[model samples]
Target: MAPQRVVPLSLRKPTHAVCVVGVEMLVDVHSDVPRGARSFEVAGSSGLEVIVFYDPERAREPTGRFRWPLHAGADVVVSVDRASKDVNDLKVKVSYFGEPESQALGHGVLYLTGVDISLDVDRDRTGQVKRSRGDKKTWHWGPEGYGAILLVNCDRDSLMSRDRDFANSQLGSLADLQDMSPMVLSCHGPDELFDSHKLVLKVPSSDSKRVGVFCARGGNALSDYKQVLGPHNLSYKVERQSGEQEIRFYVEGLTYPDADFSGLVTLSISLVDAGSLPEVSLFTDSVVFRVAPWIMTPNTQPPMDLYVCSVVDINGSNGKFLDDMSYLAMKANCKLIICPRIENRNDRWIQDEMEFGYIEAPHKSFPVVFDSPRNRGLKEFPFKKILGPDFGYVTREILLSGASSLDSFGNLDVSPPVTVGSKEYPLGRILFGSSFPNSGGRRMAKVVRNFLYAQRVQAPVELYSDWLSVGHVDEFLSFVPTSDKKGFRLLLASPRACLKLFQEKREAGYGEAAQFEGLDRVAKRSINEMLADTSLQSDSLYVQKCIDWNREVLKRELGLTEGDIIDVPQLFSLKGPYADAFFPDMVNMVVLGKYLGIPKPYGPIIDGRCCLEEEVRSLLEPLGLHCIFIDDYLFYHELLGEIHCGTNVRRKPFPFKWWHMVP
Candidate 1:
């Protein structure tokens, strides 16, 4: 914002006073004025009232000559009744000591028009308060966007309490102040000038429900800093005691933007002329703030924490898988959190229960757990354990529309940072699987989709997922990091690619080689036996078509070419009308930076090596990724899931701020 123009003030004794038109305010320096000017007198015309402040006694007018050689007295302040129009309608004159020589020189009159006041904030949205110049009321977008940002106090701040900070009317602890955004109020002038005027901060009644404000009084105790403006409190009187010039305030968002709240809340400060009959506002300054939205991290982001559950039942136990995950986490340089059987309640599908996300602001940020409405054994796990200090939790229940297999968060996915056409998604775009439009079979709950769209940063796209029995987006596709212009590669499950690998082996004289060579309780098939099964071939072809449809959708939406995608060798078997993975799905892997935890496929062994694993390593290892295959067939695959379905990951947020985007 630009700075307000300064009007010149010059009035002295034994000479003429310089007259400056469009003068707003004037102040008298006791040292600058000579003792010859015993005192000064102020008077205004019909439309104006000249109010002067020379003494501390109840803001009286200039009934007598205000003292000039004020011994240790405050500077004199003069203000006019109203702002001057194009024509200087209300002329004000001030004469210093009517001496005989001054009579020959005529009256040394000081003309005054108006005493205007101004308020300013971080109008440029650079986290610094500046002087108001242009467009302080309207907010704009783009990289050159102008406005402030506010963070939702939705995270727990105090260790003693689990309640979200915004819910508590009073602050829980002093540390709670860190979650709020900062605002500065500057009213700099002679201290005595405020005796005839007052500064008032105001918020629209509608905005009170969305924000709460607190002042930082110069005291150590919590009681010294009180909430000055909030619910039911629309205006606050700024108490600038004595020589105080600047005041600091903290603002907290009470709720996220939704159907009711537009997410844009504005606060204004006004200067009121109290000496007037009705007291009028001379000037008002307004600045806007937008509430931050929750954003989900894609696979390309480096993993910070790994989450998995341990369960023991009649089917099997995940003891071996847990050990493998611990080792992988160590290699990836991340912390591993294991959910015990007591906490998991035999629910190992943690990815289906919730998705990890976060809300951010310039001042503070925190991770948030988005709980799905699946309501399984791990339904309350996130709320009970993860909703702690600096970690937030949010959820939406499918009340009228009952939950389905597609309601699981495993169907939720987001591509790596992509640029489609001329537009770009620096935080990546959200991708979720659902039934075909008008199919009426099953889809993710509408309420969940509404919440995601309200976020606004990541645009969500729908894909066909009901073609499979356990329909999930992770079962067929994922993304991994690579050092290229695209920064990542989309890993897609391909039955055609798996078939080609087997055909090459058969032609190389490995026709008798058997899948699951040593594994028991599971049927084994020779390369020639699998090649002769026409029914299996037809099923694989149908699943390939389904995956191809999503492949096209992804390429179009993510602006990807065939070079940016890598096909993982895997097949599926038709079960009734839907399909399931023929082997442990290799594409559904846990990506942690350069380390990838892939599900081990018990394929035919040739030259003492699993061909499927060798093929996957060849495709991914060249891109600087480690493919660590684990034996998940016994527990996870048999239960109709893979590593990605059972495990969850919390990755680092994007470095690019969300407010910079035009959307």
Candidate 2:
């Protein structure tokens, strides 16, 4: 290989600064000066003056000598002419006092402009300049004000790194630097802050150029850039120069109104020199800021729709379920939609007669319907639609088209639809009793899974064994939305847990011992009833197994622990035979946003009153949830229907976006 050629270098003093127009200032320079040089001349449209100081000490008077080093590297101070106009480009030439020969420094230029730029790194906690590679800085910006702008000045060769040995072998000229004109500056930040298109540059106007402001894209930038821009929009132009492409943004028509932006934004600025063969780039430290209109998800938003049926009368009063539901609708400020029972064809009129359960979703053009339950008729119930939202009319068919041959016991005991996952990405899940292994089980599972996939819901499908007469997940479990980080917590009905709490209360000599005694007696009687029924002895075993399985599944799938579960007092009674068996299950409740509608237990009254409601309230109050008693005993509990069976909730569909799914 031939001997390697060393590239020349250029250096300038006062690397960066901000100065006003018509201001005279002294700037220093250390370049390849000829032997016996005496004077120097300043050139460039910036109109700066060049007055070489023979005594470096005199040049260091204005700015302290300590700050302005006068040494072999920077020997002379070039003064800005008092009459010089505001410009961006300045150059220097050195000459000998006795000789006429003068030579320009090897490609060195001082940037002098009217634009005011200041950098506040780390939110003003420190003003230390980063000197080492990979040193970073940060700033916070908002709609009220723009982020800081940094003044950067460096040599063209230093800006680009190329292997000279390989470049010379390729036979290409490496001295060309003018192509790097009009360097591009950009920014990157968090998506929660400003729009991805957030890098902005404000250019000043002069006799040769007009003032203009431009912007580009940023990383993790906020969504809805057009909305953030408000009435003003961004326009772009593409230009081809020196067989290269240059994309520039024009912001003359753009406006930065205070109302247009909000949230925390972290931003970094980068300078791109397009002149280099592969382009050269430099990045400044990052900055973070808080903008206005910080959008946040509400702790508990009100339910939008409720699903109720008139097939079964709750609370022993026939033809009153709809009226009771209508009252609930008014209180919750939501629309009530009725699912007429197919078994009672005559009840079809009840759908029109009822004055609730009818309303359109926010974006939906027509009223939503809770269609008749498939195959199993009214027994399986229409609440099964709770599996997921009907994305469109076609989704309704998918929800209703499931296995046809559901047994009477299986049909009535299908698990109530349970929703899991965050409010932003809710997943609809259901539990089926393994004993009721039928075509409907497989078909419904597949349909729900496909529906969730098609809708792009980010929830997983899970199953838990069911063995009780009312073999429904809702009979023993529920979910309540919360402001906590987990978004919601699991509500489980555990007779064991309830008994333990009551026993502890009794041992502590609490005033409610008599009430606890009655509750405990009722619970033991119910358990005894199950153990006595030889036909359900096997079921009793399955029930315990199912409970354990569910608890573990919830912890694994929902990321929940024992602390996340809210246990409600409940008991199972097999008194009236298999079909008549019912659970005075307090966990089988209806959720209307922040209000939890539960059944008022009508078990053996103690001390001339029932304290089940009080006990349940005491358990829920600490979690910031309110309880509403729905006197659902005679018509619902005795008839195998609980609060969840007699009533259903059609929650407000989440406002989901593609980007919101990202952690």
Model 1 reaches what TM-score against the true structure? 0.80
TM match of model 2 to true structure: 0.42
lDDT of 1 by residue, 1-663 (tens): 111222323444322121121233444434344345544444556655344444556333333445232333434333443444423344555455535234222123434334344455566666666765566677666688777778888778777775777777667778878778888876655454577778898989999989998888877676767787888789999987876767888889887776566789999987776887898775677778888888999988889999999999776677989999999999999999999888889999999999999888766788988899999899879988888778887888988766898989999998887889998888889989998778877788888888777787888889898898989999999999999777999999998998899999999999888887778888899989888899889999999999999999999999999999899988889989899998899988999999999998989999999999999999999999899999888778988899999999998999988878866
Q: Stretches of candidate 1 above 4 Å error?
A: 1-121, 130-134, 189-199, 237-243, 259-261, 272-281
Specify the poorest-scoring 10-residue window by lDDT in model 1: 14-23
Score every model by TM-score: 0.80, 0.42
Q: What C-alpha lDDT, on a 0 to 100 scale, does residue 588 get in candidate 1?
A: 86
Give the lDDT of residue 458 in candidate 2. 36
What's the lDDT for all of these models?
A: 0.78, 0.38
Clashes of 1: 0
